[model samples]
Target: MKYVNEAYDFVNHAWSKGKIKKLIAPLEGLAYCTTVKGFKEVGLGVQPEESNYFNFFYPKGRFHDSLYGDDFPAEDLVSDCICEAVKQYIEGANSEFQVPFVRILIDLMSNPRFTYLRDGETEKKYVHVIPDDDNAYLLALRGEFLAKFHFGNKSDADDEYRAEFTSEEIDEMRKMSDLAIDWSKVNYESA
Candidate 1:
């Protein structure tokens, strides 16, 4: 929800056919935090060849691996933690919940619930949009018309809605995120 306002700004310009620039400053911070959190959650360097069972991407720039099949650490692959957070949030739930970080924030900000709630509504639905950054956007309903956007980055930048994981996996991700957020806060305070 922190990026909700910015998301709305981007959406306005996107719909109005205005120039939408990447908000790199906020993204960098979020990415760093997200990377740190993910590292803590799974313990990086612990497994260079382990099966991640999770997929991650670099939101800032493009990087490539020399080997085709070797599994690289997800953190090393991406710089945008917010992007990753978006991914984890909707990784496995309803196929309708997949999307990019930007659009989701915009929808949540534009709508009232301040989360993803379409004002005075009751029921869940999926909203999809293709962001300027070449990422697909999808949102899942939370409350009455209240939906949450989770990020999913692909090579072609295809803006398609698909169920990435099962409902149980989505729930597990939610629980993991709760811990990650608290971990981030504690570390921030200590710093």
Candidate 2:
């Protein structure tokens, strides 16, 4: 849960500096700003080094600084979208335990958001996030689905045998996760 602490630290620092409000402003539709703040409070010291802590919450981007800039590219403007989506989903999940580190790593790689820049123009940059519930939820669902699929047989550890699933299978799973999240209404009001 070290990375949880890191997430908390990141948010807490922002809060102390009066930036948490702006950081989560885009999440108003997905979850209340206060609720998102509360989520960060509980996440304090949870896991300080988990990669998803960054990918899910902070993401790989410069969008955070864009709030003060003028005219960000459409595709480079969704970091907040990704972070809020991830934080809200993690909060909604019924589990108190952390996703395995390996799974988290896989999620960082296999998630489609990591592969394509927002407009497919930039070469895999994480400048901005889409900041939409559908996009965020789809990203999370894709992470979870990939974990369930490629992450089987944890002990196999053989690098060569690791590459079994096809790009088609991965795409199919992503589609399914997106559909599930799209049709999902139970707990939709909470976040």
Instruction: Return the top candidate by lDDT.
Output: 1
Candidate 2 lDDT for residue 120: 23
Residue 124, model 2: Cα distance from true site in angstroms: 17
- How does each model score on lDDT? 0.32, 0.30
Per-candidate count of clashing residue pairs (backbone under 3 Å): 16, 20
Q: Which portions of model 2 show Cα errors greater than 4 Å?
A: 1-77, 89-94, 100-110, 113-191
- Model 2 weakest lDDT span, ten residues long: 36-45
lDDT for predicted candidate 1 compared with the true structure:
0.32
| lDDT by residue for model 2 (1-191), tens | 11222334334345432443443344334322212111111111122222332222222221112112222222233333444334543444457875543344345335543323232222211111223422222111123113332221324343221222233433464476433432223112111
Supply candidate 1's per-residue lDDT for 50. 24
Residue 122 of model 2, lDDT score: 22
lDDT by residue (68-124, candidate 1, tens digit) is 323343333333234343434344224676656466544432433112223223222
For candidate 2, what is the TM-score?
A: 0.17
